[model samples]
Target: MKKEIKKIVSYSSFLALILMSVLACSSSEDSSSEEADSDDGEEAVTELHAAFAAFNSDAVTAILSDDGTEVYIETTGYPDHTSVYWETDNALYIDEPDVSKTTQDTYIGGGQGEAASFTVDATPDLTGATVATQLNTIGIAVSGASIFNDQEGAGDLDQAAGSLDWAGAHKGPGVYHYHLEPTPITSDDDSLVGILLDGVFIYGRQCNYTGGTPTDLDASGGHTSVTQYTDGVEEYHYHIINEVYAAGNYAYQPAYVLFAGPFQGY
Candidate 1:
C-alpha cells in the first residue's frame, strides 16, 4: 500500500511538471507574437520625391536624396523618349513630319539639354492661390523634363503649343521642358507625372475624369484626393487640363487652361 501511494504521488508530480512546461512555452509564444504585432504598428511612410526615380527617362539621369526634413532632386533637364529637339545627328532624334512643330525649313532645337536641379518645401502648405511669378519651371516631369507654367516667353500657352512634340515637350537644346502633360514616361493620365516647385504632385486629366467626365475642381484645378503613391491616403494635388472635347456632348466637360488659374500651394 505504501509503495502504491508513493508511486501515485510521483505520477502526480510528473503531470504537474508537464503542465508547467507547456504553460511556459505558451507564454513565451504569446510574448513573441505580441512583439511582432508591436513592430507592425509603426507607421505608414511615403516620400516627397523618392517615387520620381522610377519614372526617369533616358534623357535625364535623376538622383534622389532625402534627409528627414527635405528632398533634393538633381536631374538632367531632358527626356528619355525620342524627341525632335535631339540633335538631328543623334540616333534618338525623331524627325517625323507629324511631330507638332515640324517644318521642312525649320526644326526645334537640335541639341541635348544641360543639367538643372529643383528644390522645394518638403511639406509645402497651401496658404492660398498665388500667381506664378514668371514662366518658371513650375515642376519636373518623370521624363526628366522641366514643366513650365501656363506662359511661354511673354505669351500664354497657346503660342507654345505649336512647338511641342507629340509628348508635349519642346526646348532650345539648353533646357528642354513640357508645357502640357508628358505622356511619354507615364503609363496614363492617372499615373503620377511629377512634383511641382512647391512640392505638390501634378497629374494628367484622367485623375479628375474617372467617369469620362471632368470632376469639379478648385481655382488651380487642384483637390485633395487619394493617389497611387499615397496608397489611398489623401493628398493635395493639381491636375493638368489638356484634353480637347469633340463637338458632340461628352460625359465630362474638359478643362481648357493648361494649369488653370494660380497654384494653391507654395
Candidate 2:
C-alpha cells in the first residue's frame, strides 16, 4: 500500500512539473508576440495618413499630409458619385432613377461652396467619456463626403430615415453627407470605408474580408482586430453593420453600433 502511494505521489510531481513548463513557455511566447505587435502597431499608424492620397475625383478634391503628430486634410467638399444636389447643367449630375421612390429628397438650395479643412489625431487614443455625435460631422469618407452620426440631426434616427437617399446620402442646403454606411466607395463586405476625425478606421459590413462579423467590439462600433488595409496588423476601428445584423439579437454583441457608437472614451 505504501509503495502504491509513493508511486502516485511521484506521478503527480511529474505532471506538475510538465504543467509548469508548459505555462512558462506559453507566457513567454505571449510576451514576445505582444512586443512584436506593439512595434507593428506603430508602423501601421504612421502609414495611415498616406492612404487618403488615393482619393481622386473631378467633383471632389482632397489632399492629405501628416505632421508626425496629426494628419491634416483639405477637401473641396464634393463627391464623385451622382447626386441631385449637383445642378442639372453640371456634368456630374445624374438624376438617380430610384431617388424618387426612396428618399424623394429635394434640393433645399443655399450656402456658399467653400473648401473645408480638418485635422485629426494621427493616433487616436481612448480617454474616459462618450462624445456626443449628434449633429456633428464626425468624419469624412474616402470620397470626400462628410459622415454624420447615426442620428439624422439630433434626436431619434426614425424621423431622419426617410430623407436618406437610396445609397444612404443626401445634400444639406450647403453640404452633402452620409448618415449611414455609404455605398459608392465600398467594394465588398470587408473593404475600408473611411477614417474618422478621431483617427479610427471605418470598415464595411463584415469585420474581415474573408467574411464573418468581427468579434469583441465595444459600444462605439470599434474593436482591436486585423483589417485588410493594415496588412495583418490589428488596430482599433469601427464597422458599418449591414442591415441584417443591425436588427434583432445580434445588436447586443460587437454589432451594436452601426458606425463606431458615439466616440467611445472620448
Tell me the tens digit of each residue's lDDT in model 1 across 84-159: 7776877778864545553333323434434667765565557645765357566777777777766777776655
Model 1, residue 257: distance off in Å is 5.7
lDDT of 2 at 198: 69
Model 1 residue 15 lDDT score: 96
Task: Assess the local accuracy of residue 84 in candidate 2 as a C-alpha lDDT between 0 and 100.
Answer: 60
Lowest lDDT block of 10, candidate 2: 248-257
Model 1 segments more than 4 A misplaced? 1-50, 57-67, 98-112, 186-188, 208-214, 242-261
Q: List, residue by residue over 1-266, the lDDT tens digit for candidate 2.
A: 99999999999999999999999999999999999877554322335444455464543343334435456665666766766666676776666543432223434233644245567666676655667665656777777777776665556544545445544666655466776666666633776767676667788767774478766666676777776666677677887755432432220122222363677534
Which residue runs of candidate 2 sit more than 4 Å off their true CA positions?
1-50, 57-67, 97-110, 243-260
Candidate 1 has its poorest 10 consecutive residues by lDDT at 246-255
Model 1 whole-model lDDT (C-alpha atoms): 0.61
